[model samples]
Target chain A: MRRFVRQAAEILRGDPAADRVVPPTGITARLTLFTAAAMAFLAVFALALSLAAGRLADRWSEELARGATLRVSAPAGEMEQQLAAALRVLETTPGVTEVQPLTDDEQRALLEPWFGPDLPLESLPVPRLITFQETGGGYDPDGLRLRLQAEVPGAVLDDHRRWRRPLLAAASGLRVMGWSALALIFGALGAMVSLAANASLAANAQVISVLRLVGATDDYIAAAFVRRFTLRAVAGAALGTAVGLAAVALMPDTGDTGGVLTGLGFRGLHWLWPLLVPLLAGAVAFLATRIATTSVLGDLP
Target chain B: MDLVITFDNVAYSYGGGELLTGVSLDIAPGSFHFLTGPSGAGKTTFLRLCYAALQPTAGEVRLFDRPAQELGRDGIAAIRQRIGVVHQDCRFLDHLSVADNVALPLTVAGRDGPAARRDLDDLLGWVGLSKRADARPPELSGGERQRAALARAVIVSPDAILADEPTGNVDWEMSQRLLQLLVEFNRMGRAVIVATHDLGLVRVAKKQVPARVLRIANRQVTAAGADL
Candidate 1:
């Protein structure tokens, strides 16, 4: 640990002579910084996407799993009797906490987005929906369906298994894709850093020769390059992360839209996640530069 | 005196052509020798072998009693610290100041401090480069660059100094001054090997110090008499 601290200090307080040995390549420096910043920006969005997808999937699965809907359809005169019978069966069902039939106004509000605000409920033979909340393990749909068929023949129990399965699956898949995007961003950052380092080493071949001729060890020479690139990556990533966070913050609030597009953001402690982007970028640059410089120096002399 | 470097029946080849063959020599502490040869001769190759820059294609070369091939990367670097080399091009980090270039060896060795600064100032003063300490390598004259190279070479006070064509790009006055500085190092008990095509500088060196002149020809080394 002490040795590590000393080495860190050495990298922080670099040897001015060693750094001066390698002439700066302006294009390569700018390219590395720009690439790091761009990658960090993308990485922030990817992380937010993954976290949001995870939240969405969990909420959909849990909420849909715990509650169910019962729809009763019959002749217009018999519909009232069938819905009352269906509600009685649901209220007596095990694990069913609250059973309430949807009021005409509530049903109209649900249809307003598709049929405009003035939905003609009296003209259509609309099915009555009994929304039931559950507790503990929730009511068994098969058992509830058997009881409803025996009592209210027109009632159908929808456990939401069909739509819920596909919706949860899609959310989970989206989460995986978001995480994969993050991985791809890191991979691209590594490749860019490696190319930049290799270019710098090639351009400064004479400087390397001079350093080797003067008895400078390979590690000493490599440290100069690694320190420069790592610091640049860190700085660039920091700036990008700040901008990305601001952009995410300025996005339409999820509460206003209540849609998936607006939900691409962090919640609570999740905001701390983007802070790791710059650190990870710095580490990638450090490893890439170290490997490239050491490999090239080893090939010399 | 201890033997600083030894080449035993060593040979080197480049692109399937042998440049040095059956060459055997030993450099002793405080010894002064001059290597003179025609163009295309292997004087630089021999100096490179002495510093472990190039391994022998056949036989063996040892530095400070350790076989060259047996030394690891760090070992070679450590050995190089004890053997200073000057190139014909007088290569310097052009971006660095003359003082920084001269103090390169110390900085590489992690010995840079107030003491190193004082020593560097004294050495630059000795080479008459103290006034141009802040000047960059490209800004210095050929003579100034050569002096800076020499100062850099001897700053570490290595056991041996190998200079390849040190006076190749300088005037006669500058060559004489460089030779005088080399002779001074010889007097201070450091083995010095100078590779040059300048017989006049070789003769002057012999007059000032008991120096051996070896000439490389026909891919082999042989002693040359004073008449040559």
Candidate 2:
């Protein structure tokens, strides 16, 4: 780690004489900078998506795992008795907490979208919903079901397992996809930078021969090419990351209801991750140019 | 320690044919020598061997008392710093200004400080290129380019200077001026070897300095018995 930091510091310390050896304008210069910027721009979006998916996965797993609903359906005579018995059984349960039966107004508001608001609640039979929380370890759904079968025949426990499984799987898949996209973006960044470096080295082969004849060491010649490409990559990536963050910030956010599409951006401290893209781009450029020059110089007399 | 370069029965071959054979010589410190031969008489190849640019096909070429084939790439670079070479082509980076091009040796050696900068200025001025310091190599004429190459050669204060046709592109007056610069360097205790086809330049140099004349003939280097 210390050696790595030292190398980073050395790279940051500019070598103007060495850098001036290479020509100022070339196709590789524009190619490398453009590739790094494009890759970093795509990388920012992928990073935001992965983080959002991770948050969604954690929320679905934690919240849904600890809460359940009990629905009681029967004749009007037995419905009230069943709900009362279920609540009594839940209150005595070891892991269950915050047990409450929904009032008539609450049930009416929940059904108002499906059924008309003016429906007569007293004429027809409707089910009662008992909402309750659980401890961190959660209650056993099978044990609660057995108790409710014996005491309240009309009661059914919904541990949210049916609703949570697909949602959790979807969130996890999205997270994997987002991360895979990011990995591909970085891989593409490395490949494009290497291609540009190789082109630059080939174009400057005569210049390299001249420098070597002038008593320039392998390290000195490599520094001239490597430093130029690295600084260009860093500058380009910084611009790209800034534009990406701006684009993400401009995305339409519908608060909590927006789900996956709208809330696609850095939140809180996660904004700092994209800041490292330029540094990472510089690192990639340095490695690519170094490797390219080493191989080419080895072939030289 | 007294000899800058030595070739012990060295032979060099390329494409399965011998270009030079049975060559043996020693270059002492602060000596001036002129190499003269026919156009295809391997003068450039001989200079290349002195600087570790080519490994002799047989026998040994010792530079700074170390065998040329034994040194690594860095070792070769270190020896080159001690022996400055002015290529026949007058190669320059072309993109850099004349001043930066002349300071190429000091830049590569990591000695480009204020002292080196001042030396570069003085060296360029000595070569009559102080006015054209900002000009690139392509913009300079033939004589100017040769002068710039010489300035670059001596900018590092190299222990030895091996120039190939230093006055190949200049007039009689300019050639005399360049020869005087080389004679001055030889007086200051630096080994100098100038390879050329101009026997007149050789005759002119002998009057100014105790310059030895060598001729490469019959694939072997031999002394020219006061021929000029």
Candidate 3:
């Protein structure tokens, strides 16, 4: 283990002579840099998506947890009576801070997205929605339900989990998808780097044979390839990260909810997370080239 | 440690055929020897075994008195640093200059400092390649490349030098100069083994240095009958 660490350190420290052994121009050279930059760009966007989704989930969870709605549906003659009774019951309930029954026009606006703006609150037998705020100690739903069932029999208590859970769940899923995208971006980087390293090693077979003849160990040869590809990846990833950050910075922050227009770009210390892309890129290149070099050199005399 | 290379009944097979069988030889320190063989003979294979480039199919081949098999890949690499090899093709990194090519051994051994630079300059001058220092390997002439290969082999001041047709592409005069360099190295207490097809060069070398000629005609190597 110590030897391995020492070798890795030595490789990173670099030997210009060893580095020169590999010809600086080749398909692998350009391919590695371009691949790293492209992958890093995608990775930065994925990072932004994840942070935005996380913010959305947190805001929605907080807003949803603090309040719920009580809907009252009854015959036209008894609708007002049930609504009054439910409001009275809610006013007396412990931990219930404020209760306000939504007006007819407000109900139409709430249903406008689905039922259209001309929703006829005068004709349809729509249930009345009463949104209520709770204190830090929330009211007991079971106690409220039992009292409402006995008095205002048409009243239905909704804790709001039906829509809240799915909203929060969708947000959580978006965050996961963002993270999975980041993982795939890095994975593709590793695979591409490994392919480039393999091609470079094969192209430089004669160079390798000469180095081995002149007393170069497999570690020395491997270090040369690793140093080249790793540095290229670092430089490319830095470029990509810069451009990505700049692009994110220029995005319009429009909505209070989260998406590209609002919370997508990093805020405060969160900006530091994307900076890890280059270091991770270099690490991926190092490991991939090391494996490729070892495998190729093993087949030589 | 008495011998630089020792082969004990070593045999090697390749391509479904045994190229070398029951071959035993000893290369003592500071000795000068020539290996003469036909084209199909195992001369190159023997030189490779001497440098631990190939493991013998049977028996043992020891380098610096340590069994080649006992030395792992890294260990063999370290051992190879003490022994320099010059191939018939003068295998070089064509992208590097003549000076850098000559200094390749030191570079591979991780000694590319000022001291190594000084050695490279001196060696290039000795090989009459100082003027071509900046020229790449492909830019050099046949004689110049051979001289560069020679300089590269001795750059690290290895304990032993193995040459496979070191003068193959050069003229008689250039061959003589290369032979003289090998002889000088042998006089400096570094063992020299030259594998070549030119009996005339071997005959010329015998007159100047006390050397033995080993010929490989069949699947074995035997000491040639008289002083060449």
- Against the hidden true structure, what lDDT does model 2 obtain? 0.87
Compute the lDDT of residue A240 as modeled in candidate 3: 92
Predicted structure 2: clash tally: 0
Model 1 local distance difference test score = 0.89
Question: On DockQ, who's better, 1 or 3?
Answer: 3
Model 1 agreement with the true structure over B88-162: per-residue lDDT tens digits: 899898888999999999988989889999999999999999999999999999999889999999999999899
TM-score, B chain, candidate 1?
Answer: 0.98
Higher-TM-score candidate of 2 and 3: 2
Which regions in candidate 3 have their CA more than 4 angstroms from the true location?
A: A1-4, A72-130, A133-140, A257-263
Error of 3 at B107 (Å): 1.5
Q: Which residue pairs come into collision in candidate 1?
A: none
What does candidate 1's lDDT look like per residue over A1-301, in tens digits? 5543454577677667666667778998999889999999999999989988898888888889877889999999999899889988988998997888999999999889999998889888999888888898766778888999899999988878897999999999989999999999988888899899999999889888888888888878888888888888888899889889999888877662454457989889999999999999988888788788879888987
Residue lDDT tens for model 3, A31-130 = 9989999989988999999998888888888888878899999998889988999999999999897799999999999999999999888789999999
lDDT string, candidate 2, B94-176, tens digits: 88999999999898888999999999889988999999999999999888898899888888888899999888888988889
- DockQ in order: 0.67, 0.75, 0.78
Global lDDT of each model?
A: 0.89, 0.87, 0.88
Better of 1 and 3 by TM-score: 1
- Worst lDDT 10-window in candidate 2 chain A: A1-10
Screening candidate 3 with a backbone cut-off below 3 angstroms (N, C-alpha, C), the clashing residue pairs are: none
